[model samples]
Target: MKRINEQKGFTLTEILIVLVVAGILLSLILPNVLQAIERGNVTAHQSNLNTINVALFMCYTQERDWTQCADITDLTDGNFLEEVPENPFGGGYDIEDSPDVAAGDINAGKVACSTVEVTVGGDTLPGTCSGA
Candidate 1:
């Protein structure tokens, strides 16, 4: 009589158990990973806002006012900034001068010239350079 060798492999129940365990582990870890990504976006958005603040302040130093500029492109065009940094969260930066101050005034109605507002993740996260 010839002896037969039994080939060992993962049974269906064992495979199912492994898959279930894997799914459980993934479910536990995925939320943390998503949270980390969101936090990263917030940090990046804040940093971008701060960078915009610096550029805007530099523009103020040169022009003595913040009224002439309305957007990030103005900073680049005026050479106050080398390049406009992109918003990390997907929203664009808008320069909001003090509405009370008329255009061409020294203050140009700028209550806060060096502050930049940023909204990220479809406005899920909103922040300012001052806050950052």
Candidate 2:
């Protein structure tokens, strides 16, 4: 049987093929996009940590004692940093010293973003920071 003036449109197989290709492309690209976003977050996290470290340096120069400044508030209160910067994953950066960690460790004297660890080679260290 034949129909007159049949509409011209994509067949089911063609539509499905197009959808499959789109899905494949999306699958290939989505992870890369997500990874790039995470990388940006990691970079921002490092920048924030560096900022806090600079503030810590200022605190150390003024107080002349690491024990004197053991919290982010110590930096903020002392006018070293205008405000506290939160970790990218959430929560605030920590200032750790003393008996909790041994000397020469990253978090020992000064380490920010204690939650986010970055592994370079075999060493796993927290995200370093930079501040204004």
In model 1, the Cα lDDT at residue 24 comes to 100
Model 2 score (lDDT): 0.73
Give the RMSD in angstroms, all C-alphas superposed, for model 2. Answer: 7.6
lDDT of each: 0.69, 0.73
Point out where model 1 deviates above 4 Å.
Answer: 1-5, 104-132
- For model 1, residues 1-132, the per-residue Cα lDDT tens digits are 866997779999999999999999999999999999989977886787677777877887887766656677888899867877777667576676545445554365533433333445556333344411
Give the range of the ten consecutive residues with the poorest summed lDDT in model 1.
123-132
RMSD to native, candidate 1: 4.2
Q: Tell me the number of clashing residue pairs for each predicted model.
A: 1, 7
Find the candidate with the highest lDDT and give its number: 2
Tell how far residue 115 is off in model 1, in angstroms: 7.5
Off by over 4 Å in 2: 1-5, 100-132
